[model samples]
Target: MPQRILIIEDNKDLAHLLELHLRDLSYDVTLSFEGPKGLAEAESVDYDLIILDLMLPGMDGLEVCRRLRKRPAYTPILMLTSKSSEVDRVQEKPTNGAP
Candidate 1:
């Protein structure tokens, strides 16, 4: 069976494009434009992976992740963020000795 996936993204174009590409790769993909709806979809189905956008309507990806982590069953989550942040957030030491 194809691996099931759920994508929670507010960007319609990006989400649709991703769905198309994943489908071509033989993966089953489902999309939700908001955090709450995505959470509902996730609970209703057993997805192999979840592609979640950091910024969302109704709720943010951080909150969604927190809630999902509370569940007994484990489902891997892949979070995506378009916003740029400090390199330290990724826990990497700068090669140039910069913070």
Candidate 2:
């Protein structure tokens, strides 16, 4: 069985390109354009790996990671970031629920 991969990226072009490459290598890939939907997809399957994006529409990658950790997704997460200030941006977000 091919190893399953979930890519949570808002960039459709990048996500699809990555998916194509991974598929060429005989791996199964699933893509989600938003954090909330990605989290839902991640929880629904026991993917071998999760490729998360730092910036997303509904929620941020760190928040998704936090929620998964709360339930303990049991899947490895490989977070991707393009910005140098990703750390600062992630830290600024509110946790423990929306205000």
Candidate 3:
């Protein structure tokens, strides 16, 4: 089975770009524009990886990441954000097998 990837990006163009790139790489991709829906999907499905945008509506990506971590959901997460602080925050997390 293809590796499953979840993408939470509000920007339509960027989301489309990511989907296209991952599809070319032969990975199954799912997208959610809002934070609540994204969080719901995250809980419902088993994803190999997740690409989350920081400036999501309803819930911030940092909070989402923190929540997932609290649940001990160790699926690899790649945060896609415009904020410079996002990089700093990610560095604090233990990234194991993350691309």
Which run of 10 residues does model 1 get worst, by summed lDDT?
Answer: 88-97
Higher-ranked by TM-score: 1 or 2:
1
Off by over 4 Å in 1: 87-99
Q: List the residue pairs that clash in candidate 3.
A: none
- lDDT-wise, the better of 1 and 3 is 1
Per-candidate TM-scores read 0.86, 0.85, 0.83
- Per-residue lDDT of 1-99 in model 3, one digit per residue for the tens? 999999999998999999999999999999999888898899889899999998899998877787787675678788887767756656555434346
Cα lDDT listed for each candidate: 0.87, 0.90, 0.86
CA shift of 42, model 1, Å = 0.7
Model 3 stretches astray by more than 4 angstroms: 85-99
In Å, residue 30's CA in model 2 sits off its true spot by 0.5
Highest TM-score against the true fold, candidate:
1
For all candidates, the clash counts are: 0, 0, 0
